[model samples]
Target: MRLFRSLDYATDADPNWAGSLLADGTLPSFRGGYVGISALRNSDVLTAVSIIAGDVARFPMIVEDKAKETIVPLENVEYLLNTKVNGRLSAYQWRFAMTVNAILTGNSYSRIVRDPLTNEPSMLEFYAPSQTEVDTTDPNHVVYRFTPYNSGYTIVCQQEDVLHWKFFSYDTFTGRSPLLSLGDEIKLQEQGIGTLKSFFGGGLKGSVLKAKGKLSADARKKMREDFERAQSGAASGAPVVVDDTVEYQPLEVDTSVLNLITSNNYSTSQIAKALRVPAYRLAQNSPNQSVKQLSDDYIVNDMPFYFEPITTEAEMKLLDDEQRHKFKIEFDTSKVSGPSVQDVASMKTNGIIVGNEARQKLGMKSIDNPDMNRLESNLNTIWLDQRAAYQAAKAATKGGDAHEGNSHDDNAD
Candidate 1:
C-alpha cells in the first residue's frame, strides 16, 4: 500500500477510469493510481513521500484506541492519507499556502498570517511546474513565468490572522519548477507585522483627521449693523450745550427818610425801615463821634460834629497848617483887636509848639541847668596848658635843655 498520494494524479486522473480500475481490481496496475506500486520509486513520488514524512516527524501521531482499530481508522484513512497529506505537502511549494486555505476554506485548523508592518492578512500561490528559474538578482523581486490563466491553486499565508498572497508564472526554459519568489511578500508581511504589533502593543488606531467651523456671512453682517445702530443712538443722545444766565435791578434811596432822621435824631432801626435799607448798612455810613480836651480845665467834652464827606479841594485844604492856624485864633474882625506885647514876646522866644504831648508834659530837671561860667574857666585852663607844651616842644626841636622846663610848664598849665 502507498504511504501517501500525489494530489496532481488524484485530481487530474479521469474519475471514470479510476472507478473502472477499482471495480476491475486493476487499481494497482494503473499508473499513478491511489493503490499503485512503483517498480523503481519515481523522484516525484519520493518527493511527495518526503513532504508527508516531514509533517509527521514534526507532529508525531499516537495510538488512542487498540480496539477501535488503528488510531486513524480505515474509514478516515483515505482522507487522512490523501487530503490531509496533500494539504501539508502544499506548504513546501509556496510559503503562505496554509494561510490561503484558511481564508478560502474558513478552516479552523488553518490560520491567517498578519504582516508586521501593514497589519494586513496575506497568502501565497505556486509557480507553474515547467518554470525552473527563481529570480535571485534583487532580494525584493519575485520574477516568475506565469499564465494569468490556467493557474491551479492559491495559497493563503498569514501571521496572526492577516492574509497575504503571491501569483506565479511559467518559464519556457526550465521544465522543473522553483518557488515563486516571496521577498516582497516577506517585506509586506514584516510591515503588517509591525503595524499589528503596534495595534496590540498600544498606540493610535488611524491616521490623523481634522475639521473647522466659522461664522456665516449674514450673521456677521447683522452683528455689525446692530453695533453701528447702538453707537449712533449713544452719540445722538449726548447733550451738546448748557444754559447759564444772570439778572440785575436798579438801586433807590429816600431823601425824606434821611431828612427826618437828621431832624428828630430817630432810632437807627426806624431810619432803616423808612429808607428801606438795612440797619447795619446805615450805621456803617454814619460819622464817628468827636471829643476835644480843654487845656486850662483838663476836661474832655464831646462835640456835635458831622464828617462832611471831604470831596472838594476847599474841604481838603481845611486840614492844611495855614488854614488851621487861621482857624485857631479867637479874633473879632469888627473890632480890629491888635497883638499884645506879652503875646509878641512869647512868639519871639519860641516859634511854635513842635514837641509831641509826652515831651511837653515832662518837668524840668536840676542836671539840665549846667554852670556856664565854671565851664568857660575850665576850657581856658586847658588852652593855656596846650600853648606851653607847644613852646617847649619847639625849643627841644632846636636841641636846648628843655626837658625840665617842659615838665614845669605842664604842671603850671
Candidate 2:
C-alpha cells in the first residue's frame, strides 16, 4: 500500500553488503546515488523530459494480429489497454504516467491482477517498490511487500504478467536510470540555476570594502552599519555619504568571462539527448527544418526502441501460442504518422504501400474497385482494368471486318 514517491532500487549496492543486511535481517540502505531521483525531479530538467514522454504516450493504441497483420476492433485486449489499465485509471492516464516514470527513472512496473474465477487478467496495478525486495539469485523474481496497498499482503508476479518497461538496462535486471548516467549534466543545470538565483537574489555582486586610512573600532562598526543601511534601502535609491578615507569596490562576472551560458546550454542539450527528446520540445527556438528533422527522429528513431520491446513481449506474454501467432499489441503513432507526397507515391510505385491504404491515412475512403490485385504502374491515373479494355477492343475489330465484307457483297449484287 506504500505510495512510491521515488525509485528505491539498489543499482550500485555491493553484493557482500546486501548479504550482510540479509544475515542481520536489517533493511538495506536505501541510498539513492548522488542527485537522487526526487531531487533531480524537483529541479527543472525533468519538466522537459516528462513533457516529451507524456506527449508521445498520449496516443492510445489499437491491437493488431501478428499472423494476419490486421487490426482488432472490439477485443478484450482493447478494453483492457484503452478503458482500464488499472481499476482507478484509464489506459491513457496510466500509460502517460508510465512513460513519465520510465523517462525519469529509466524503469517502471505494473502488476497484472487476474479474475479469481475466470483466471483471466482483470486489472493492472502500478505499485511502488517502497517495500519490494529483489531476489538476486533469480533476477526476474521480485518479492513485493505491500505497505498500505493491502494490509498484510505479499505477492510475487512472474515475467509474464508484469510489464517492466525500461530504458538502457545496462546488461542487468535493474535498468540504469538516465539520471545516474547524466548525473554531471543534471548537476550543471541545477547548479547553474542555483548560482543565477543566488546572484540575482542579492541584487549585488560580491564586493570588497576598503578604507584609505586605518579606522578606530567605533569607526569600523559605524561603517559596517552604514553599509547595511544602504543595502536595505537599495530599492528606494537611498543615498549614503562615503568619506574620502573609504571606498567600495565591486567584483563582477559576465557570463562570457566563464562561458557560463554555453555550459548551461551544453548541459540542457545533454539531458535532452539522453532522454531522446528533441530540443524544441523544451521550447528551444529551432528552425522549421530542424523541427521537421526532430519530429522524424522522434517517430522513426527514438520511440520504437521501447514500444517494440513491449509489443514483442505482448506477443509472447499476453496470448497463448496460437493467439500469439495471430495477434499483436501495438501503439499506434498514426497521429504523428507521415511521409512526403512524393515518398507516398514512391511507396505505391514500389508496392511497399498502396493507394487505398495511403488514402485511409488521411481519413479518406478506399478507392472504389473490385480488382484489388490488378497492377496500375501509372500512379498519376486511376487503376486501369486491363481485361475489360482488351475484350472491348477485340469485339470492335471483328465488327469492322464483318461490315466491310457485307459492303463488298452488296456492290457485286
**Residue-by-residue lDDT tens digits, candidate 1, 1-413:** 11123666445432243443332222343222222223113222233323322332232112122232212222221222123433334333332233222111111122233346744323322332221122223334433322223445333322222111211113321111111121233234334555556544433212221112454778656644554454453442343221232111123434464454344423333423322232334333333433111211111111000001111111122123433333221101111122344553344335332222111122211132333112122222335668989778877776655666788899999
- Assess every candidate by TM-score: 0.14, 0.72
CA lDDT scores, all candidates in order: 0.29, 0.60
* Per-residue accuracy of model 2 over 1-413 as CA lDDT, tens digit each: 13222334333422343433322123222323322245345434566656655654665656665554446563566677667776588887777776665655555667777778856667888754343444445555544333435556666656666766666666545554565556576666667677777767763635667986788999988988777776764553345456677787767667573466434577766666766667667655556676667787787787786677566655665566666656678777654666666676677666666666555444344556654333336544433577677768889999999999999999999
Which pairs in model 2 have colliding backbones? 1-147, 1-148, 1-149
Clash number for every model? 36, 3
Best by the TM-score measure: 2
Supply the global lDDT for candidate 1.
0.29
lDDT of 2 at 18: 49
How does model 1 score by TM-score?
A: 0.14
lDDT of 1 at 366: 16
